[model samples]
Target: MKIKCSKILQYGALEIVAIYFSLLMVMSLLTGNLVYRRSQSLLAAAIIVVLTSHLYSDRRKYFITWGALGTLLASVLYIYYNLNDSSQVYLAIKYLSFSLNESCLIILTVSMLWQRTKKFILVLLLILALIIPIVFWGYYLSMDAWFASDTLLAVMQTNLGESKEYLSDYFTVSGMAAIIFIVIVAGIVWRNMQSVLLVKEKKHFTAFISLALLVSATACYKTRDNLILNTGWKAKENLQKYADFQKMQAQRKSIVRLNLQENGKQQGVFVLVIGESQSKDHMSAYGYDKKTTPWLGEAFKQDNFIKFTNAYSCHTHTIPVLTYALTAKNQYNELQLENAVSLLEVAEAAGYETAWLSNQIKYSAWDTPITVIASEANQQDWINHNIGETTVSNAYDLKLLDSLKSLKLTDKMLIVIHLMGNHGSYRERYPRDFAVFSDMSSEVGSYDNSILYNDYVVSKIYEYVRSLPEFNCMIYFADHADAVEEKLGHDASKFVWPMTHIPMYIGFSERFRQKDAAMVNILRNSQDKVFTNDLIFNIMLGLMNIKIPDIYEQENDITSTYYNSDIQRFKTLYGQRFVREDLQ
Candidate 1:
């Protein structure tokens, strides 16, 4: 009996093998984790593809249509991976596989709607047309940063005006060219490949395949951390988690009690200044060659000031760092962020009027966890308004200090000032007058200028706070550091030791210094010891002499006698690795 070639090719068995094996080979080559479990995932994915192979009866059309569109999408990923210096090879391959899986999904869905394939395809194309622009924007962003869940959160947490401003700043010539190229290519593909269609199949078969595909997709999402499975879904998951966190915080706030001991005066002010993307190494006070921190350098001479020489941020991203830093959660603690009480709550419970003055956006599409924590304060002042969700704005950090003057200071106040200091687009962070560094063209120069401006802003804030009749103590620390010299932002994907080395210092008034001599001495001695911002909650409590025994561990507080400087063992990036080992 002669084997008919048509029978063999009718079900697209050869096409399935060709496409599946090619994808598998590419993915396997990119990653070292081709172990038994991962292999099982690959096998399961292949089975789903095989089950759906019958939909593509016209093998030629299937290849042509998806091939053209896939290449276009692949080109963007290629550009992104090439531009993103920190992109690991395995992750790139994982994303590539995700792209193929996403294409498979589109194909399966379109095939199921065989009666209206053309209409479905048209609708899909239109959707892609809209989504592609955002993808293009991300590609341009990848030039200086890696895409992450945090990046998505920031994007969602911005209004249209800010989003437009962000696009204008990062949108480049290459991005425009790429968009034009994709549009022209996509138009040609759509015009020519409109005839592609799935075979007329039974409704029962279609339903079965659809269900199978759904299960396959769910399994893949559960097992793999890839772009297709993770991006939007991960962002949604984070938002839900934050919602849960808000609920938990609401419950915890009512029961939280601070152990406060009033020394002499019950009426005093304490200020916490949170800086943005500032590296301690860039400051002259930290021994940088440039005098970018003249004011801080001068402040070092004051007996009341104590600068922490060895401070690290637990995470390089703003949300994670701030989430841990502002709350009773740290790298060393097992407390879930959702359940932890924030510094604002602690301060509020202690009968101190808490104010959150920020040069950051008040709210975006989604309220970031940081925003939720910030909202817990009795009084809130957002100076930036929505000058884009990012710190790349003219709002400047100094405005926050000015806003402080407007607040009705109570007898006992806890003021938290969040600055937009030295974030990205460093030139925009400061005015021309602060551009003391001659070479404004270079990244190094612009970054130093921003630092210099930050120093001035912070010093001015210090002077104003110190001059206040009731102000007694102040603490300043950055969310995370930037590798300005290396032309790198504080992206966790490309994290370097310097990215965690943020500037941290505390100052006391002469009256306050005399009141808490032992606390001041403890902090002074612990300055040279290793500290991470995640424990800022503890130290803040220590400053107010508030002790929640279950939540606040004395060892983590720099102001405590039992304070431990052994933070080398602390982990970051969701406790995947040790901070010290990463430093090494």
Candidate 2:
């Protein structure tokens, strides 16, 4: 058997076409993008045309081998750069590893189509063995709980503008199935080749065997480097980007020092309850049909709870929202300046024993300066409770009550309680016993129950605050709202601005209420439809009745507006400014 030019051309075209098809199939499985499928087909057609041209001219191993190696290497490097630069290296490796592992099986199939024997079976098994390590690598990169289907879907939809459902349904399942299909196809090709080929054609099979082994080796080595490069580049980029962002942020940070003119004013205790993932729309207090927030509704009607009718959170996520809300710049652009003085720091400076108790895991991390300010007390005395122990559960807001009880409050105390209220999966956030509604079949019932549980927790906190003789004022608001459930056709994780709109209620003790009646009424009627999270700093200033410096008083001062406005100007000016700066 002599190596004919036509035969070489045919095999080379087949190899290129097979590789292209495998790439497209894997990409389609990973991204579920129709455009990618079309692109893959076009590229494969081009490769076929080019190979046919080469065969028409003369048989050349150099063109085929070099082209295959170059294209594969370029693709691998592109995937690496995108993943590394975007702080999504894990996902990059995951998708690439799966693609290559699947491609190896495809290579085996193509190889066996040319020549099959014990050698082909051995090579197939070798590739199959490789799949285990690749799969394990994918799993290792996805160690975080947020990488779960629900969480990742939400995150992808928010960041990428594509629903996780696309990735989950088509990409993930189909990719795995395609990999298995390739394995099966390889076995079939091997059996078919063995039946067709005899001992006389053995010499002709050498080129095909060498091509398969070389392709597999190249892919394996490239995939390994892809993982290493992605992870290494990600770490370097994060540090550099954070440092650059911090430098930019520092240029704009002009911390205002309060000038205290009055010396004899009596110091009082205040509590700010920061609720997590609670939507005002679900609360009866906000006129929802369900009586989920009965206690809060009663409190609001009685004028005990001075409700801010239109208040929105700065950001959707806990870390971003908490950071922005507490910092002087309650916007995303100023996120790098998170270490700047917060309301807690201001309160602490004013001779208040500031204590922070949180049910959030991330809040316990010392990386955040706001967390440090909140949990300034001794670690032994600080309450870092994890109430949500179940797989899909969130901590009950009532858990904060026990933590609060442990704290020794002073006359001038600023207690910041970060509650795990209504943090989803909705059903797990609440107890089964709280499923009072008859219509328990639907997701709405679960949400209503979760809202009710949150309400009950709020009531308990209120009762505790009311019992405290030294506690003069209290402010409560959720960090952000929840999205509709998964079954509702809406992405349950994408936070709408309306979803970020939360209820802000402030209450004062009888004595403090009488003394600050004018200020209270001004706050009640303040028409400024300012963002609630931004009010943290100004509210602290107002409560302490201290004069803030001119530099901090420039941008949309809620206090200056008497907290009254239906302008919704916060979105237009403040929102656009941050977006513009972020892009720059």
Candidate 3:
């Protein structure tokens, strides 16, 4: 037991440094501060301790064991607290835990084998210990500003738009920080080499660590819910998601989703206008008391349009909802949803030239799932690329018009218009003159006015498509809805109706109606059917009048009389699903 404890103490000293550095990194993550701020001062103090190690010879005996235990304890605490996938605290917990385990294991193994190659093993151990601080310090400089997001991780890898430019900026910012980190690391090693030698063992090592861990446990328990720790985990998870998405992209090319039979000569413009953060319950067209959708109500009066009263978004957030909505995967096929070919790809395979136009943003530190879906377009335009969340943009949904007009004319075109819709800073979503709901409360009025602005944008697009000589049809649906609860924006919710109940409409030009009156009648008859947006690809396929084998379900599509709705089938706001009869 004495021999074993001596071996542990000798090698465990290295693990102590690992623990100290790991603590700095983990604490920095918990506080949502840069590693440099925590590490630089910590490293300097460590250097001072090492330079005067001869004066603290008695303290060295028991320090390593306590550090090892403290590090292990800290890692376990971080892992225990950040289990929530969405928590910002979840960000760096995964990597930090893995690194702690790896560092401890390496030190223990190298220490056990110290008899045969003591000098070489120690050198290797020393180099490895330096890695913990060196890499984290550089990471501090490069990824400090980064929030854990699929888009942020993707920005590091892709050549698309401003994401690549962000990476270029990363190189420039990390240069000076890297030099300072190396210098500090060098100073610590120069002064600490003698102390890294054999240290005397003491009996009270475990007692010291126990007290430290007890104090640490209390601190950990107190700040157990800090959201920043998940930031790193967010980046890590999104990177995995991005990888899965890329794999799906590759596999999607070989999906061979060509329709077996054609309904007719497929030549016309099929427009899919996707809106953001808009709740149907808030819109007048969907029975809201306010005139939030006056122009949309006008379109509703026309015989060429069908408004679906029972449409719900699959997910509360924009990215995930879009993943299922624009793809062939529905609730039943969600397990294989990542591999599902996108609607744009399906339209292209069905022999239509595709275009994507967006008014919200192009990229925000990452290639958004919507951006990946839009990548399938032959021509794509993003009107605004600003990365600020609180930005009061002068840009409006009407800017999508310029992008639409820029597209080269093709006989059979599938154009997707992604709108800002009722996204927050609602007042900024439209011009001040369009604030028709100003008489209402400020928050509610701004939101209602944004909806009113969306009504005009949708009307203009409908009119534009109708003016085109070719047979034209358009479908508009929000990506997801928002809850204006005390003026709060939409977030991940377990049971919220306002955040998922989005408005959907299908509009056909007179020429399109003349050519496909049967389909128009089908759409009108099925408007009241309750369905989730996950199965919306079926509706989109119906609008394009081309169906892929094994993916389309007539029973779930709003354009089919066979459309079925049960309490369990289309899960809505809460535990209670939408009933078609109740909708009426």
| Strongest candidate by lDDT | 1
Off by over 4 Å in 1: 1-20, 32-57, 67-105, 108-121, 125-141, 144-146, 158-189, 198-227, 258-267, 364-366, 387-395, 582-584
lDDT of 3 by residue, 1-584 (tens): 99998876675566547645866666566545544432333333233223223223344532453234224324333433333232333334433433333333333333334566756666666564454344434444554422223333433433333333333434345645764756564444333433433332535544533433343333333333333344445666655665577557756756644443463687888888899889887888888999888888888898988888877777666666777788776565544656777888778778789998887565443365567778888998877766443233436788788777778978899888888788766766888878887688887888888888888888888877777777488888888887775333453422345777788888888888987788788777777767688777888777777776676678767776676766456664222345333344
Candidate 1 residue lDDT tens string, 456-484: 89888888888888888999999999877
User: What's model 1's TM-score?
Assistant: 0.83
Question: What TM-score against the true fold does each predicted structure earn?
Answer: 0.83, 0.60, 0.63
Q: Model 2 misses residue 4 by how many Å?
A: 12
For all candidates in order, the CA lDDT equals 0.72, 0.53, 0.62
**Better lDDT candidate (1, 3):** 1
lDDT rank order: 1, 3, 2
> In candidate 1, which residue pairs clash?
157-364
Give the per-residue lDDT digits (tens) of candidate 2, residues 493-573.
222354565788887788777877777776666632455576566666676565545423434445454343434344412
Residue 304 error, candidate 3, Å: 1.2
> Residue 524 deviation, candidate 3, in Å?
1.4
Which prediction has more favorable lDDT, 1 or 2?
A: 1
Native-structure RMSD, model 2: 10.0
Model 3: lDDT of residue 340: 72
